[model samples]
Target: MILAETLLFALALIDCGAILFLLIYYIITLSDLECDYLNAQECCEKLNYWLLPKYIAHSFITFLLLFHGQILLFMLNLPMFIWTTFEYFTVPRGNLGAYDPTEINNRGQLKKHLRDVMIYIGYYLIFFFIYLYSFILALLKGDPIRRGSDDDIVTEI
Candidate 1:
């Protein structure tokens, strides 16, 4: 249990860290005028480069959770893994014409918007369920096991 807890904690930390890094990168990219000036092909290449590490980190977290023998964590991780994988596949990449951003009124733009909405819904639903489950587990189990804690103690004076 201790080992599993430690591994989960580490995975959680990695996931959280990767999330922060991605957020920061996203903010930086959005803040830059150079990004807007870049051609569609260049932008896609740059974006993919930024996304690759985040994909790896998310995958690692999911793998850890799946193998850790905890039912709740495993359930929580599976959807997240799938969502990220979906995003990776759906995301526009390289110099392909598929990636060119059209006007909001265009049919392609509407399709993209719908896809984004569905992905957001899926991600959020999974996240909410994971939190609810974890909260219930915490209530039932008191707290997760920690390393180097005294599980058994005897004192005599």
Candidate 2:
């Protein structure tokens, strides 16, 4: 139980870190796009670099949670995992995969992407809090196994 808790805590920590980094990157990209500092193709290309790793990490976390019988926790993140996985497969890879580069303007697409990122950022923040609470509760509860004591002594014939 302790092992499982520890592993879950570690994985959640890593996931939270990834979520933070992603949130920052997304925000920067959105700002740059809005300010005309970064072109649509460049934004997509930069974000492309993060897509696969985020998907892989999310999948691993979901798998680990399922393996450990964390059904509730697993369910909470299932939709996000499924959505990301689906996107990973359906979306084109590399430059301009997320948007049509030939389009005269990508402002609308960038706005939509920003909204999606904000939603994910909120979801991940909530999930991180839940994971932190679970870890703390597990620590407080402690192990079920009692420490060694002089209770029943073995007798030799």
Indicate which candidate wins on TM-score.
2
* Model 1 spans with C-alpha error above 4 angstroms: 1-4, 31-41, 90-157
Worst 10 residues of 1 by lDDT: 96-105
Off by over 4 Å in 2: 92-95, 143-157
Candidate 1 residue lDDT tens string, 73-104: 66766776786678667745543332333333
TM-score of 2: 0.80
Each prediction's RMSD over C-alphas, in Å, is: 7.1, 5.9
lDDT of 2 by residue, 17-113 (tens): 7876787897898778779898867876777778887788888888888888889998998999989878777855543554445441544766777
TM-score of 1: 0.53
